[model samples]
Target chain A: MSASVSPDWIAVDWGTTNLRAFAMQGGTVVDQAQSDQGMGGLTTDGFEPALRALISPWIAAGNLPVIACGMVGSRQGWVEAAYRAVPCTPLDTVLTRAPASGGLAVHVVSGLSQAAPPDVMRGEETQIAGFLQLNPGWDGVICLPGTHTKWAHLSAGEVVSFQTVMTGELFALLGQSSVLRHSLDPDGWHDAAFAEAVGDTMAHPERLAARLFGLRAGQLLQSTDGAIARARLSGLLIGSELAATKAYWLGQNLAILGTGAQARAYRDALALQGAHAIPADTDRATLAGLTAARRLLREAT
Target chain B: MSASVSPDWIAVDWGTTNLRAFAMQGGTVVDQAQSDQGMGGLTTDGFEPALRALISPWIAAGNLPVIACGMVGSRQGWVEAAYRAVPCTPLDTVLTRAPASGGLAVHVVSGLSQAAPPDVMRGEETQIAGFLQLNPGWDGVICLPGTHTKWAHLSAGEVVSFQTVMTGELFALLGQSSVLRHSLDPDGWHDAAFAEAVGDTMAHPERLAARLFGLRAGQLLQSTDGAIARARLSGLLIGSELAATKAYWLGQNLAILGTGAQARAYRDALALQGAHAIPADTDRATLAGLTAARRLLREAT
Candidate 1:
């Protein structure tokens, strides 16, 4: 998309590994920019320069309002933004705003924190907010699949409660770095094996540790193929996640807010358990949520 | 021990990450040798050089038999030794031998394989055999803890059945590489937390996945301690393993054949569930098993 003559504000989704910014004119994204200088890569003071570098061309005359989400608001990010408690409207929640050296007024969307059992999420709050905007007052469960997947219970247009599972990160670690790497197929997936593994783990989640070694043992015994092994590994991990999160999905309208294969896998796994997951693009949801936050700031001013 | 002037044979327990050799004079270990040149670090041809390098000084005039166990007999190792089916005597099970270049009559002990539910073990089989030798006619369960911890059921002086859990490896991966690394205390562990996690997971193993994320969430929420996180990580992994292998431990004389703190941890975890796990040295058991195998071969000859 082409940049508008003068944009309303810059919407930034500053995560751990990637930085994405969208130039917004009124309510639509006019121009987009990205950088690898995520919160993980930058020091305390590097966030502004990274943001400035991305939206330099779009910043023409006056100081532009920048609404950021994700780890950019964490203590490790550019500015330390305190988290908002759950069971509150993410869009309406008090955001942490900080002004950088440049002519930039920045507002960071605070993450949602749970007191019970202790859980927290940053950028996902923005996604949840955007999802809520897309379908106003749609109360159910929105499963946000990522390196750390989040299952949020949405009720009365608020994030009532949510929990996280390190599903994606664990999968990558096991499949890429663990001993089972030799047996698992890196690029293939067997639907049947994945489904069967999911069902097995869901029914008896206690056997997770025992079944994990089966991925390697099966290959040694010549009873399992690479594709099946890979699928089963994924199946078992996700299945265990589902088993822990049965309360969130049972009799609830489930929606998966994620990007690629992992998201599709989540949808498919839930489908097998009689809970069809509605899929949503993470980027779109993030943008919509940021836009809503910007509108709220406008009204507050 | 001292090297015998004229040793009868060499007992070699070669595994994926370690190479241990004990020179046997007559049903006893005389001289000992070891190297980091495990099967994992060598090609097919490198095994001979590695072995010769360690025991060449102790070699006598005749072609001395070298009884080996573990991954050195794996398909990817020195020779593709076939797996011996279980419910048979591990000491009496036929071993595959490769004729090395230096007049060394090499016998590689094949690991035990299970057909039902698909399971296999390489180095641990040797430990099982040795444990049986120490406790003749011991009809109970033997828990061998390591990277791939194994629990074998011995009945009437034979390995009736066994199961493997990636408990050790999983603990290492999560504590070292995963996000939980930041929160978990690398140098310390809390006993109370460990026991609590063990009991919690044993009762409700489904919470393992959720509890895994709790380690990270607790840190982020400032509601968790580093030492407790570390112990809980170990506890959760072991607890899940114990839950799956409950069939082997329930109302059985459980002997944990392993080395170091990990084995002790397993023993303690089992103690919580009313099952007392007797601790045994892994290296001692392996040596005993190799000696017994060499003895059986000599008698057969």
Candidate 2:
């Protein structure tokens, strides 16, 4: 298969379960595509073919400079990129050119890792870079909530340290799989119940490990409505995360980076804690980061 | 139905999903029986016949005093016994006699509840009562790890405010239904991997929500052996539980009350945490609780 030379560059945000690609001409995405061919998917089917298939239409149109982030840089991704250890700045971001295939220049981004409890982030580094590009002079905390909610502490354009909370994924698992699932009303948010639970959890956050059982008991005893129980459980989790990250957000400029539905919930939660949650464009940031990396590569050349 | 003359008391531990009865002669259980007449099942079948059938054998011999616990005390149960609020002693335990049923004394135990962020326990109170009887002067925590793991802090004869964790039910649900379950080895526990995961989780306990995706990622990337991944995920949850409850067991004596295969796992986990875990007799404890409640009633009369 031959690669065409139409699009100037390709920006990819590849994560554990999904692959997203944007075709950029003069640093703006002209066309977008996505596939189930995430880093997770490629682990079984192999990397090259999956990447080729996802961007085949763009690739067929033109030979483009490709910048990819996320698990594609993990030991299990298409190719392993060495982790950039933290206190990472824009300059510290590791960039490696991919093997030229069908006349395309592919650059895979390096994942970031911290030594102290040995935490790591793959695609999020790109998001952080994108965040930095938009809010150039801003410095404080950027919280990206998801399965692994990242709380990054930025100082002088550098990511000094960050903490990740497993809030979203835990809620999904508990709500869908556990007995608590029976008690959850997933359709709407019960603010009163949620607030009550969040307040209780904030007061005695340690009790979260214990209070989960109350969902089943409350349902059986009719003391708690299904919707309220679900809300309470969700509140307990979000509250615990809030307690852990309170020191990071207290009296600091806080920005929350999220997409669509999750972002809305996070915004509501941040308000409860009296923190400013400015929604950063997740897609825009990924493209901006890729463009920034591409320009850096071009400038060096 | 006519009541038999001066029948010995029959004890019942009718819970949400199952009903168990004991024919007590003096202080010993001379005959034992069980029925699928769980509160869940009785909700459709009506409570009267279900209760009669469960103890018909013992009833045929003599009209026995039936003492019940668990969901049998709920509005959905045979009768509602009302909730006994927290910081409550055994004397504070609500014991309600069954409504007019021909000289038959059916006393149902009350469920326990906390204040705001209300948590409640029904079957557990009986278990706690049984534990108190067995260890008269003991002062420590009795952990009943199950669908809803209960951690009771006992001082003298009173049950101090205890907490409940939904560990077991969560494990079962995530293992059987969640997306991660697809990547599990399905062959059961892999000890080395499980232990490693437990250790890793203890170190970075907060990553629990995100680390879950790794199961699916590993399966896709082929970086993780499916079997090992499953065990590792299980270990991660167990480890998280251990971390969450560390303070609960740190300086206090720990005794795990469980039975059969699940009990063995709890034993291993307790050992890992350097806590003393004794397999309390589950059947014996239930029987003992019913017997103790009966004696208290007869003595009060």
Candidate 3:
């Protein structure tokens, strides 16, 4: 399609397992679209087709400068975006622009990596940038919990360093695939059970691994309540993660970037750990980051 | 086929996932046999044929009494052997015998169940009985670790009560199905890392579920060593199970019933928990249980 006039610019926050796109006019998103056709899905189907399907309507209107973040820039992404080192902020950094096609100026954002232990992230860097953009002049610890949960330290608009957690994914696997599935009531959390487990784990963490076996044993011994066991297991794992992260990024103001159930859970956990948590809208931050990238391109030209 | 002057017996241990059989002459195993036709496998292959295949050799020799235990008594096993309540010892009970063609006596052992929290055990009862027989007057704790690991409290040749742990199966599912697999480095255990994680978990036991996210975070932050992360995860889970068991059965003499690598792992873990563990020969116990069943049959008639 030939470009007649510039349509509203769009920003896409695509990650390994989630794809979300936002329509931006001026500096805010007017409309948004989402699909499960994340980067992980594109590995099976080529990336171009997936992108085309996601934004066909916007593309048909006119060519738009689309800035994307998340897994779309990984080695496994549509195109590999270089990694920015730690202690870098999103505002000063410009996203890498892909070769423009069909009047679409596409920019795939770079993720961040640390060299010491060779840790890396692809899509979260932009989100971190977005988080820093919104919470300017804030220096503290921010946790983004999901399939791969991130605990980041930011100071003076820069992402100093971050840690990742696999809590959600582990819960899913254990719940769905293990024999413990038989014991999980799945109605909701049992507070007493959860609290007891958390208290027990916090007291004697070394027994954490061995204690997992107790779930099945409790059932066999006629001493276990399935719902309680399920909640307890959940508590043990989540509590252990919190303790580890505490050790890594201690004595920092903590902000949690998530929404709904998971965010609430994190809030409760942080409270138990005596850490204050403030919730930041992750989706909005993603859009803002992409919007900033588009504005940067416009100003450059 | 006619009845032989020598008494013939068939022994079967039908577990959830596997079925094993032994042909015996004069209280000695003549030849051993097994099939993948476990209770789990029998979902498709009905009961009669499964039993026939297991004892086909003995069927060819002459009609014999077939004694069985494990899942064969569950709703899914060959036949549901009604559960006998706890406080009952092995020698105090014998399975109900069904007379089959050619004078074969098919005896399906009864499982033990508890009413309070409503837990049950089938095959393990026989193992417990066999263990009791071998030790004669031993008392304390016996742990059988597997997809459904069992921890039993025995007193005066009686299995007082037992608990189960779904440790092995959970490990399999997490290692194979979860995204954690991508981050796992399974070379060997990292002591410092494992100890740190264990310590952290003990301090904040409630966070075990939430802490799982830190596995990914540790990988991303370059703070977690991959190989150690895997072992650490294992430690967290196993350690949790041990902690729970300790709460219920602490101060009891401990004996572990398992073979090969799993047994070794448990031995080490129990040591960490300050529990001295004696390894019980699982395979020998299986054979001993079968032999004891034969003795009981001869004495009955």
Per-residue CA lDDT of model 3 for B1-301, tens digit only, reads 2245333777788787778887767556667777787787665347667778667756775576688877777765666677787777754346666434556677887877766434566677777777877788888999887776778888887777766666777666665577666668755566656656555554455455544545654565564567787777776666657765675446778888888766776676677657788888887787677678667766877
Which residue pairs come into collision in candidate 2?
A: A4-A62, A4-A63, A5-A62, A5-A63, A6-A62, A43-B220, A43-B221, A70-A123, A98-A106, B185-B227
Q: Largest TM-score belongs to which candidate?
A: 1
lDDT per model vs. reference: 0.87, 0.73, 0.70
By lDDT, the best candidate is 1
Where is model 3 chain B poorest over a 10-residue stretch in terms of lDDT? Answer: B1-10
- Model 2 ranges with Cα > 4 A deviation: A1-6, A44-46, A90-105, A192-200, A214-231, A268-274, B1-117, B132-147, B151-162, B167-281, B293-301
- Model 2 agreement with the true structure over B81-168: per-residue lDDT tens digits: 8888777764333488766365767888887776544567788888877877777787788888787777777787777777777777
Please provide, for model 1 over A1-301, each residue's C-alpha lDDT reduced to its tens digit, 9 standing for 90 to 100.
4532568789999999999998888778888999899999989778788988998888856678899999998888888788788888877635677658755788898888998878989999899989988888798999998899999999998889998999889999999999999998898999999999999999999888889888888887775789999999999999999998898998899899987889988998999999987888888899989999988888887
Q: Give the CAPRI rating of model 3.
A: acceptable
- Say which prediction, candidate 2 or candidate 3, comes out ahead on TM-score: 3
For model 3, how big is the iRMS in angstroms?
5.3
Cα misplacement distance, residue A57 of candidate 1 (Å): 1.6
Question: Residue by residue across B1-301, what tens digits does model 1's lDDT show?
Answer: 4533567889898888889888788667778889999999999779898999888867845667899998998888999788778987776646787758856789888888898768888878788888888877788899988888888888888889989898888889999999899998887889999999999999898987888988888888875889989999999999999899889899998898987789889999999999997778877888888888877777788
lDDT of 2 at A1: 16
Residue A6 Cα positional deviation in candidate 2, in Å, after optimal superposition: 4.3
For candidate 3, give the DockQ: 0.32
